[model samples]
Target: MTAPALIRGYEVVIGLETHAQLSTASKIFSGASTRFGAEPNTQACPVDLALPGTLPVINRGAVERAIRFGLAVGAKVAPLSIFARKNYFYPDLPKGYQISQYEIPVVQGGMVHFFVGDQAKTVHLTRAHLEEDAGKSMHEGLETPGCSGIDLNRAGTPLLEIVTEPDMRSAAEAVAYAKTLHGLVVWLGICDGNMQEGSFRCDANVSVRKPGAPYGTRREIKNLNSFRFLQMAIEAEVHWQIEQLEDGGKIQQATVLFDPNANGGRGATRMMRTKEDAHDYRYFPDPDLPPLVISPAWVDSVRAAMPELPGAMAERFVTADGLPEYDATMVTQSLAFARYYEAARDASQAPKLVANWLMGEVSKRLNAEDRDIADAPVAPATLAALIGRVQDGTVSNNAAKQVFDALWTGEGRDVDAIIEAKGLKQMNDTGALEKIVDEVIAANAKSVEEYKSGKDKAFNALVGQVMKASKGKANPAQAGELLKARLA
Candidate 1:
């Protein structure tokens, strides 16, 4: 990892704990439905509700997903792991404890590689453990004043809590890591990766210390559901910590909440509770459940079923398609996007052009409309056709953009049809182009004189005038060549 730049004479240290809700039909230890948006408490079964005489049964599907994740990150899938009871007191925790892996988690160690801008960085993973989610405490729209409602619908949802080491040095690196991990899990089909619906979320642990000094007290910001919030909360917390240290105050260890609307909507973090150590939870092996074991055959089967990972596909794009690393990474961000890129590249037989258009115009439009690649108005074949026109000089770069807009806005479907309808074809008629060049030279005598006096800008001005005279139909490179020949 590159050495992180000092921020205000302090080093900003960050780590993330991301909880990805596994895509299983039922809860981790119960038969209750795992579907979202069900009526409150309707999805809770006997084991989820912790009713009398109910024993937990592990879900095979959840275990399979965890194994998949371990393989994806190159983590160690422990042959033997144990489930422990994490004793805690919360209204949403029906069992008064969370069933989780403490001493021995399923996934041992791994690393996530991503780019913090142009600089490549890698964050090492400590572990990813299988756990059951707690219910939500809804404080809004309660019938009684100052009262909150408990919804157990999400109580038993299977979750894989992926913990990263303190490998990030800044907020940008942290967000990048989170995004890359999110894409990987979604690509693997293990998690839905929906932050808005709480299927995936992050807890950021942020701290600051003087250069070459001991690590300062850290605060864990809980439940940052969006990337924007994660960054904002970290920046806000870093500022607060620096200010406190400069004010001769000591930083305390605590778990805090990010209130985006706090301080008149500037966002701020407030104390939730003091940070807890491992002993605070009083972890102990669950007597009702025996030790979880996995054989070598189980790991081999999951490895065989796994699809090509993002890194491998990106490498292929670089080697086979000759795309740059950055472009390859962006196009392979999702499986759908990669498919679209491959289709367009193969159809156009122009790899670089296809990548440029996909990452440039296609991504811009999708982001503007808040749509995914699968929802793009212009199909991959249609984009490839447009790229082909550009390659064959059927349209200039600017004219091709106009055609792209037409296709994107549903003004036309066929690339050639749009080009023809808009009269955007390049002027390849040598005699006509020469005539326009002569007209531009006569009309812009001042620019012609300046060009003779060794001014490059004046020569470009003459070329522009010639293009204008042709009503933007002239191919820019060919027009320049014609003008230069006439001048010589």
Candidate 2:
């Protein structure tokens, strides 16, 4: 990646705080159903409601999921961790405080390595702590004027809050890191990675300062639900901060909200409130729940269960398949895509050809139709069959593309059948191809004379004539070789 651009002699610094909702069936401390989209307060249990006699109990499944994430990131899972109550007051927070890991979070230091363009970047991890989600507040469609309602279904949902150090210099790097993280969690099957349903959310901390200067005052952009909005919000925030500093104004630390449809349905951001520090939260160990503990054997078991990671799989693709780095990376972007690529390569024994088709024609069609690789219409075996035909010279590359289109559109099923029906089979008979080449040479006498006079274009024109005479069924490579031999 090129160096991050400077704005008026200032550099942008960014860190991310991401919340991934664990795929547990019930709340972390209570047994209430963790299902989303429930009626208001329907999923909240007595403990979630902070009743007089209810006590919090830790969920084993949630803790196991957190351990899975910690292992995936190469973080140290603390043998013993504590849960503290983060004292805060909000309408949706029934208990006046949230149970979270503060001084001794479960997962300790780690790093996330990702590529922003061709440059590899690493972001250090502060910690990944377990926490419970707060209830949601809805203001739209209220019966009373200027009134809002609360839905506590998400109140006690389990979450793993992954915090990163201020290591990014641009919005692009931050988005790349977020995307990588999203893929990792989804691949691990610990989280659903659904941004639309609030399964995953990002809060970007942005600041700007002179080169080699101390860190600048930062603003937190909260609840960026989409990656596009993440990039845009960080960019807008950076510009806003640079403008403030250039005008000799002090930068303030605060929390802000991005309104993508603000300013008459355009895009802008507004300050929500001043940002809170650790002191403001007044954290203390929770008296209800005991200290969390994990053993080395448990960690080993979790690690053993993980599937092949994306990085390792990509490297294998490069070394074993002789694929370019870009092709390997693209094919391994998701688990399904990687599986599809592997199946095609194994079936066709033409790794490069399969890679090209997947990254080129297959990806193009998928993007145009807005479909995922898992939802692709053409199966891996079907694609491999097409590649095999191209390899064996049963059809030319262009003809193979036509067969592929027919297969993609569900117009035909078998590869050989489609080629036969469309008469796309290449003219591989030596005698027949020689006759066609002789006819083309006789018809293009002037072009042949131009070729003997050392004109390369004339030679190419003669090849095109051969292809045209054969109705585009003759293999271009074979025809070119035959024509050159006859000319000699």
Ten consecutive residues with minimal summed lDDT in candidate 2? 260-269
Which lDDT tens digits does candidate 2 get at residues 1-488?
45667878999999999999999999899999988777788999989989899999999999999999888788999999999999999999999999999999999988887777767788999999999999999899878989999988898999999999999999999999998898888888989988999999999999999988999999999999988889989988888898888888998899999988765644667899999999999999999989998999988888898889887898999999999887787788778889999999999999999989998899899878867789988999999999999998999999999999999999999999999999999997999999999999998999999999999999999999989998999999999999999998
Over 344-382, each residue of candidate 1 has an lDDT whose tens digit, in order, gives 888889889988998799999997887778899999889
TM-score of each candidate structure, all chains considered together: 0.94, 0.86
Worst 10 residues of 1 by lDDT: 113-122
The number of clashing residue pairs in model 2 is 1
Off by over 4 Å in 1: 263-265, 442-462
Q: Give candidate 1's total backbone clashes.
A: 0
- Report every candidate's CA lDDT: 0.92, 0.91
Clashes of each: 0, 1
**Winner by TM-score:** 1
TM-score of 2: 0.86
